[model samples]
Target: MAERSDFSFLDEAEATCRLAMDPAATGIDLCLILERDALLPAVESIDAAGFFIEDVAVLDVAEGYQARYHFRRFDTKGRIELRVTAPHDDPHIPSIANIFQGAEWHERESMDFYGVTFDGNPNPARLLLPEDATIKPLEKDEKSRKSYLDLMPEFTIVECAEGHPIEELAAKRQAEREEAERKAAEEAKKAEEEAKKAAEEEAAKQSEEAGEAG
Candidate 1:
């Protein structure tokens, strides 16, 4: 039978300590960090196992995927992390922000920066970006195209600037308009000169006709 030990929440430094305790934990390993959407399922798994889960956060990756949900609990003398792998395309998991208030900003930050949609988050907007600002919708294709309507309407919005931002796009269009106007002006000036020349020739021909008739 498994041992029954009390569990505690791990602090930031303690989390690092737990990582150092493990040799196979490469690059600051903290066991498994589940996605926010998978938080409930993960806790259910642990609860079913009779294990305790304490805290949760959005795993921060410097260069790789960041939408990964990271949760942990302090076991006997060590910390065990809870993690889940979200689907690559349309990758979304359940949100546990309801259970843990701390997950609010963590989930918001993840959705804001990484662009992952949480199912039951209180606020899922880009917390880092300005409220009205829209730079990184966080849900763009590989090429940065905004098509992220995958998140539900009721879920919290953690605004990352503003999604579908067209400020730069509008500027580009303005520049194009100015260029077209300049071209049109040039064409009009040329046409005016040609018309003036035709009028002068017509007047000269009329004078010659009058001289001949006289």
Candidate 2:
């Protein structure tokens, strides 16, 4: 069997989301808990790292609506899940259709079934339900709904440490990304200069050979 991909990188990606749980109990490789505002950046990072969306699912829980995005890489043997929750009264999560075109259909299907609104979805029309349908057949009654945390006991929900709010984490992450970009640019420039020098040296050596031949 192929070795499982290491997800220690997610610990460094705390800017995208809180690295909440070990997915061993959850049957996945990694589970990331994201706030609504961090969803796009997290997904963007996932996409940049070569993972593709496997599916987008919504759960109607007592805490509210839980949006779960499953991601997997073609070259890897592990799965990563992104979880975000919206209040029951406000079941709105940002749509990732712009980042992953395939998510448009999945979001529409969730809208039809669970009444979860995927904000910014290009086409939010019903996918399987009738155009005039208003009732979301999959929405459970309050009594029937389960607590989000209860369903996912593996998640470690802890209060943010003093002076390290989500906003601060996000800002730090941005700075780190900018620094990485700057270093990459510098490296590329250095490589280009070295290549030019090598080319010039080759040309000088060829000219010397030609002069000797003459």
Best by lDDT: 2
lDDT of each: 0.49, 0.79
Candidate 1 residue-wise lDDT, 1-214, digit = tens: 4332333222221111121114144322244333344357555554544444444444323222434333333433334454444554554757667765667777776666555667788887768877676554444455543222221111111121233222333345568889999999999999999999999999999999999999
Q: How accurate is candidate 1 locally (lDDT)?
A: 0.49
Per-residue alpha-carbon lDDT of candidate 2 for residues 1-214, written as tens digits (9 for 90 to 100): 6556666656555433454455566657667777798789878888887888999989998878889999887776788888888998888999999999999999999999988899999998889999999899999999999876456534443334345334355456668889999999999999999999999999999999999999
What is residue 5's positional error in candidate 2, in angstroms?
A: 2.6
What's the true lDDT of residue 167 in model 2? Answer: 38
- Which parts of model 2 are misplaced by more than 4 Å? 12-25, 153-214
Query: TM-score of the candidate numbered 1?
Result: 0.39
